[model samples]
Target: MADIAGRAGVSLATVDRVINRRKGVKERTRQQVLEAALALGFLGADEMARFRDRREANIVFLLPAGTNPYLRDLGDHLRQRVALREEGSPKVRCFFIEGFNAPALAEAIRRNADWADGIAFFAIDHPAVREAVAEVAANGVRLVTVVSDLGHSGCDAYVGHENRSVGRTAGLLIGRFIAERQGAVALVAGSRHYRAHSEREAGFLSIQEEMFPHLRLVGMREGHDDSGQNYRHTIALLDQNPDLRGIYNVGGSSGGVARALAERGRSDVAFIGHGLTKDTRNALVEGVMDAVFHTDPETLIDRAIGAICQPERQVLPMKLEIVFRENLP
Candidate 1:
């Protein structure tokens, strides 16, 4: 009740009057209160589902406007769904926001909350984003964190892989693949704002320490998921470390890494990354990249929709499928 009132910019008494079916509140005010209630996940699962059924449900997907192919694929998948959506089905919409801007993402979340029945967004580990999510939750809005996470913010669900585990798998693959893992392994990422990347890095480091203690992990270059930046970073990594044994990217732009390896004629360097995009698939096939972790965009979208329309269901963490050069399929 307090959450709703605060979010709605109304009084506690007004929220009480509106929620309790009292007659004193203005219709617009009452609606505002209700919207807030819904945005913040204050509504029960049944109530949330009914709310979706009562009217045209609006689902907004806010993704990073970055160069990451996987994020683009996710947006494309959503847009395609939106274009082909049937009558009475939930209306799906997507927006690409600045990848690293937490304040901007938070603003988008709040703005979308005003009218969106449900919102799914690429989450970052930022205070502003987390606060926005908390506010949305307080408003009773169903929110599904996509890709990365906002960590413990009261989101309705999360629709992505276990990032840290994926990272560990990458480490395991790269460490094991480079049988003579006596040299440094290049560590690169899209950005630390993405909790996924950081978590993956942590997991990778843990594995390296536990299993591949002989190899030194080096250079966490923030590519911001931009291929050009990643390319430059990889080039720099290569120029600096002649004995680079492996490369593991916790974020996107595996293409850049592969190109750098090719240009440097470093096929001996075991390369591993996330996402199974066209470029990554080709890289795997060509043996430029040793392995990659991938999860289908369709699964992510399906889970996001399910969480929005039927939020009561148990939301499990999605698994990442490891794709190796030998197993291109």
Candidate 2:
């Protein structure tokens, strides 16, 4: 108890009061104590009992499950929070749904409607999905979108990179690297079902057409964020466009692309894309990829937690990091 109090920066009596739900403790102080207990894993039976009696605040996080490091890292952070047990702690849960299946996602949301206090998720652009989110909002549950914006859908706030800006960064990097070469540039994405991928591709192309007119974008290929699809598509694209000089991964399968490039001795291509997962890191180190625009997944999780705790602490804008072999952090 003393160690918990020390870690929580509160007195033992205050900790006891919080654990036992004694009267007169401010909400802020109580929350701090509870969060400390959660982070430190020093929760007690009394805290568990008090948690059961409180109005269970549930925060459900929905994201597409795949091999993408960014998504995996975010999911891992959420899972850690869900593992914590503390009085009055918001019960955090995560759902890994199929790619942009609006009906399926909505059904999950609807089924948990009664208990959900807030929902933080990646935005899906389908009309049914928007309507479902609208239904949740109508029912008074706070909804937040991460890594993709759903501002038009009346979401509480978005916690991610500006998709267009992320794309422009990729464009500038690819364009600057290839210079005025007449070689074709390729864009591989997850799926058009995702707003982020589409927006990124649009932004990348907009810059390519306007500023780097000489750099031809061959076409945007959908990887569905799958390894096998990315590998197969990359091999075929390379074969079809032997003169392709640059590649940009708007989303997904960057690792698979690295493997394909390395196998075919095509590492000379200026590759730029998203995330800094283990595989992406390896690619950068081995010179198979030129650069990566990473939006920190841990920071996204922290922002989600902050929004849940203090809804007024305006969600911070996500940073689009430019990671090259020279500056691989």
Candidate 3:
């Protein structure tokens, strides 16, 4: 107890309170003592059992609701991972917000702040959401931003792919595939409000300007990650630019672009997109999309759970995986 108190920078009384699960110890201090105790291997079986038998943490996950098959599958994967966990793990609850509205997301966070031990969400980069995250963190709730990050929002951790790397990888593939083509390429995005999307667009444009100067960049459009909007955007791009040869979808709704291309008999256009869902896989097999970039949601959920429960550890970025028709699972 004395060693743990010294290592954790707390008094022995505080350490005793933390170890015995007594009241009046702050969450951060409790975590520090726990980490120190674990590191020193000082916890006996009885102490360990007492820790494990504590009340389960109530964790709330906020996801976007719509036709985004990727997010839909990701939400399902998170739920399943929680369900299959061993006893004594945190209790996870998921909520899907409509239309990626910032206010709606903020409301969800505020509503759960009183009861939830930890809150994780696919963040929309907006002032309201950032303020909400800061507020919750100030109130002693652990916060994690997943998939898309809220920059400098004081969240405890971020669990997702390095989005810029994902874009650079996509750009390299698109650049190589379109080396011999003599036409402009179009870029479609869900929204610039997402730091992930903007970072991806920046990386893609940088690669194109640096390596693929021969292929012109026609323009970029916001599809809002909706298929109908993406369909209209694709049609407009195709109509305006008769020499368009490739498209890089930096966000969701790849299926809409595929449908538009098929309808216009433009299968020859090189389509590169993100997310390896049923829609993207079908598009790849049918020769509509050339490649898809993805990351495992199960890995993301596991890492997020670790970050929430074991706040002393660091949360690392997830690896980006690219899939083609030949490697489709």
The model with the greatest TM-score is 3
Q: Candidate 1 at 5: error in angstroms? A: 14
- TM-score of each candidate? 0.84, 0.80, 0.85
For model 2, residues 222-288, the per-residue Cα lDDT tens digits are: 8888777888878988999998999998886589899899999997789987788888899999999
The candidates, ranked best first by TM-score, are 3, 1, 2
List per-candidate RMSD values in Å: 6.5, 10.1, 4.7
lDDT of 1 by residue, 69-172 (tens): 99898888988998899988998889999989999999999999877778999897888998888888676567898888877888878888887888888888
The list of candidate 1 runs beyond 4 A from truth reads: 1-53
Query: Local distance difference test, per candidate?
Result: 0.84, 0.79, 0.85
Candidate 3 lDDT, 26-94, residue by residue in tens: 476777888889889998657766775657777888988888879889888877867786777778888
Candidate 3: lDDT over CA atoms?
0.85
Output the TM-score of candidate 1: 0.84
